[model samples]
Target: MSLSAPVLAFEENSGLDTAESAASCALKLVRHDALSKADLSAIEQLAHQPAARHSGNVFFAPRAVAASASLSRGSIDWLLWFQDGRLCLAAPVVISRIASFSLVRIWTHTYAPLGTPLADKRLRPDLLFEELADRGFSALACPLLETGSTLATAVALPGGRQDGRAGFWSGIAERAVLTSDWTEAAALSAQRKKKLRKMQRTLPLVHRVLRGDAARDEGFRQFCELEAMGWKGAAGSALKQSDTALAYASELVASHGAQDTLAIDSLEDPQRQGNQSVAMVISFEIAGRGVVWKIGHNTDYDAVSPGYQVILAASRRFAAENTPIWIDSLAGPEHPLVGWLWPQRLTVGTLVVPLKGSHAPARTLSGFYQAEARLRQVARALRQRLRR
Candidate 1:
């Protein structure tokens, strides 16, 4: 699973040839520690500034914190910096090996929804993918990518096709821009404005979103309780109680806190008196990018649309800061929330590549793909039947 010298050379040699002026920047692969604290801080600061692209929780800074926390089990080999002296590129080439397999996977450190190339929007993926292939990674998976991202546009598989799925989902805010003024943002869209007005009118009826203090030990407990009482518990879902899952959540929050951008918003109302906490949405601010992680709402409060209000409130608050940020709902297109929030799509998918000179790896990948295809077919059929 180790990165060979040839692979590293291939990645370094692949450079962007896009027509954009920003594409002229030379791409460099350096050890994770190559980024000086001052340089990292500068990038962090610039990422938070207005008009900065790809500044979110999953960039280099947060990754540094998360890695230091010892929570991430995977190894972080290098930080891919595509820079031109002053302007910095934020995409880090994270290398990790799959268990029970000899294949190594390379990806943009995009574990969360906010993960994106922290470079100029003009950054090209063709060069990045070429470098990734040259690095000899068996697969390049970019999870939770924004739908219209330049990286997504640039990446092409060996067969000259993109490998990923794009969709929306319910219970989360879609990709959206928070304006400089909350009031102005409220008026930006007539539909959104109308919904906000309605929610505001209904706010008197036991509806309010509360931000919890992560410093308090009870913060995680309260979040878990609300999440359990909402959906996970009733469904007996493993995500509610899984230590691995909880660790990931805690890690992301801690990482965000280190960057001074971690936020937890919970929906509470007296009318929904069964449980004080109806819905909880966890968001991380990394270098100014706002990414909504896990969101859960009590089924009991679903009738009143409490989740939507909480999201709206959070969005308004973010907009008031005048920071260029994106709130990702991180759900499939068919999600109920997509209907109301109308956040733009953030497409994401797992990229799988069969290992060369290894019939075993290729065979294993083929079986996995076949199984996945079957599952997708079944899901599609089920969905079509449900539509009837």
Candidate 2:
């Protein structure tokens, strides 16, 4: 598919009755390198909207994503969604293969856990699907979507319900997200609580949040160094493991810092020889919302559970604020530590949206989803058994 033209146009449904119906929508296909300065500005504004910000996704931000695409060495193709005669959403997608099926899907990488697109408002997925179907697409495979989010609701499968497009009540289950009111899961054991209490008192801590260029840079260095001192480094998965990963992280920090959305919070051990940081967390603020992006700890301080401590402390502070706010852990539901401490969860899932008039492919993919879920469950069981 050549990237030079608009694929489809539709009547934008702006609420005002007097609004001109001539305001039309076009799903423009643009490559990353082809994006103009004006286009970047528009996308930066789009990142401020709920679909991106509420999910704590900085990846959809213009500068941040450009950095990502450059380093990931992948094709960066974007479908710019225009609704109400205005740019409503922007997301990179690929018509690629999955189990012998060539499907249109939200482009994703290992580092990007959530595949939610950057949308200014709720978009009608049904309309988008019909348009794609008309354009020869079979289905849209959306993975890692927050089940209750704007993009998810727009694309969730309709079960012939009363409200056919109610995504708040639909979608397949994929993962769990930790939200503000996160204390909803079953309580931890008394013994476990007592152990954690003991761990907290083990280190006399000075919790600090670093901003500004100099301090934030130093904090980032500390984080990478600490992470490299542990299993992540040995496993070749730490930020310092590869120059490309390091550059990507650096670019993200710089981009978010310029937007006043980046912060490095750490818990320093005052009693340590030189007041070393025991745990560090790199986080991004999306307006009032927050995302805990990366965390690292001094394995020597494992007895104190420094990583979890800093995160919980941050969560407590968030909850203590007068204004209501939510933060995403950015960890998968299978993550042991995050789910245990933060009990409230956001149901995330993959949706297979069958393009209009092309029902077979979507049906096949739906069956594939079921089988994949079963396999994943079995894999988890095997892991548990191995651990035991």
Candidate 3:
């Protein structure tokens, strides 16, 4: 069947107003390809709201949403809850199912991390979740949800939970962020600072802060090349390894650059042939906060610790221009360099909310899946331990 333009549909008792009126409000499900001009405008407006200020900008805009869907080879459906003609809650989901159990998952990717749903202050998440339960979704998988987030207070799956149940297969989204203090030389240990200084003096290192669409695009292309020359290339996981992934990178950078939120910083070795870049870090500024989204480094410069030098310099520069908001690294928890650099932790895990009046079979299926997730976690833990 051909996809139609974005259509707004009403559902009973879905409003965020009084309990009665809220139930009668409409919940709009707009497919990514079907978003209309009006829908985009509302989403943009909703993105700028104070409540959404902390949610990363990538998942809020039309271009970012479309790019993620295309790059990840997944379809996105935005579940919208509106009150008084204004958007109260906006959740972008990629639907999946297990036999009878349908799930609405917050779209995520290895390259791009997504935050929680964008919901205004007036909207109650628990009530909205219940409403979704009525819509035939057996469960909700909110990955990349920060720990202690009140927005997604529902029960969690087999991954990390507040109750201290640690699953072996749990993945943590520990966004590496730098505080304003990191920009200061005093923030570094005496040995680290001295090493950085020595590297700067001995190496013909050139740092360039690339801005605007053209420069950002150029940097992205260079980044792909740089990453492909490293371990990721051999591992077949670099952006250039897949056309779709590359397109997604291009789209995301272009979108963020157009909004003036994209920042690409590169550390080049001027003395080297081709003026090769030693390290490059891509970051996005959202609501005065910086998120260090991606980093690529030339393994040839591993001896010089090019990634660390570049990231430190970039952090200092970013801190100077903007009030240093916490810059989330979006790196894995056990990242060697990033973990050492940023001592603070932001926990990320999956949340599973069983739909209202969920049947026993569906709940049973969820339990089975959770068990499998736990086993995977255990295997992962064993691998890490053995590697050590």
Candidate 4:
């Protein structure tokens, strides 16, 4: 299904209202097809800005993921709101039937770690939820929500109604925003200062930093090589054993590029010769927000902590630009990196609403949600371990 200019068709009684608000206008839900190419381009441009919220989970944020999801059997939709015609909120909604329970389930980029609604920081949760409910969705499921997100707070309110019967999965959303003054970051922690000092001393010994679109291809290869060596090289690891997983990573990288979000910062070791890209950090630039996607280093260089050094360098670059961007190290709270870095935690939650008159049985829906929560718990545990 090639969605090259799809029109958005809303069902009658669809909760969304196109009416503008004087205080905080009504929420608008536009289908993926209804968005114009220019609208997409504008959103993409905002995503790349140094201060915008660039979430990979949003359908329109990265073209590759959006296109791939569109082709899949799963029903994927996009929701957005405009303020005086300016894009304010954007989220990708994936609807699927839980095979065991036969219940309709909706999620945003289930495969990724952080799935926050990409919207203007000023957006209100009540307004957003009212729009969502109007669209005919009874519940919203957000796995890997940060600890204190406005969206999470909104969903847990009276109108939102929390489902206490079904236990929730918890994950940490580690984030730190770069300020105009890079030096202010030093106040964050003594350990951060120590690491910065060590990296500053060691940087001259490693290869130079690779920047911009010109270096992306080579940088991507280095990132993959480092990633493979770090995790996939381990026995029975998913990345090593699953071709689909590898393809997924490659697809994300490719799609980010097609959508102009791919950003790489790498360090080569000139002292050690021949075809080895020792340390690399891959990040996606969205809405001026820098999301740290992945980082890897040659274990051989563990003594020097090359991976840590690469990240420090990248952070400094953003700081130097004086950009109000957050380095979203989207990891679980238990992860050592998250704890040590001490990034702010934002909470997110899943909202499940039962379609009142669906043909599907209720028992089926209950079982599906149960299984979903369990699966989420397992995934969270594994992710926490990886951060260590």
lDDT to native, each model = 0.49, 0.64, 0.66, 0.52
lDDT of 4: 0.52
What does candidate 4's lDDT look like per residue over 29-119, in tens digits? Answer: 4455566776676566545443244333333354444544644466556655655556655665665544433222333443354655555
Candidate 3: RMSD over Cα atoms?
Answer: 7.7
Q: Order of all candidates by lDDT, from best down to worst? A: 3, 2, 4, 1
- The TM-scores, one per candidate, come to 0.60, 0.79, 0.81, 0.66
Name the TM-score of candidate 2: 0.79
Clashing pairs in 2: 182-344
Off by over 4 Å in 1: 1-74, 82-115, 120-141, 153-220, 238-240, 270-275, 286-288, 300-303, 319-325, 349-388
The TM-score ranking, best first, is 3, 2, 4, 1
Give the range of the ten consecutive residues with the poorest summed lDDT in model 4. Answer: 1-10
RMSD of 1: 8.7
User: Once all C-alphas are superposed, what RMSD does model 4 give against the true structure?
Assistant: 8.4
Q: Judged by TM-score, which candidate is best?
A: 3
Model 4 misplacement above 4 A:
1-39, 45-62, 67-73, 81-87, 97-111, 120-135, 146-204, 235-243, 258-261, 351-388
Tens digits of lDDT, candidate 2, 94-143: 66655545567776665666677777655654455555666766667666
- Which residue ranges in model 3 land beyond 4 Å of their true spot? 1-18, 70-74, 148-150, 153-175, 180-183, 273-275, 359-388
Lowest summed lDDT window (length 10), candidate 1: 2-11
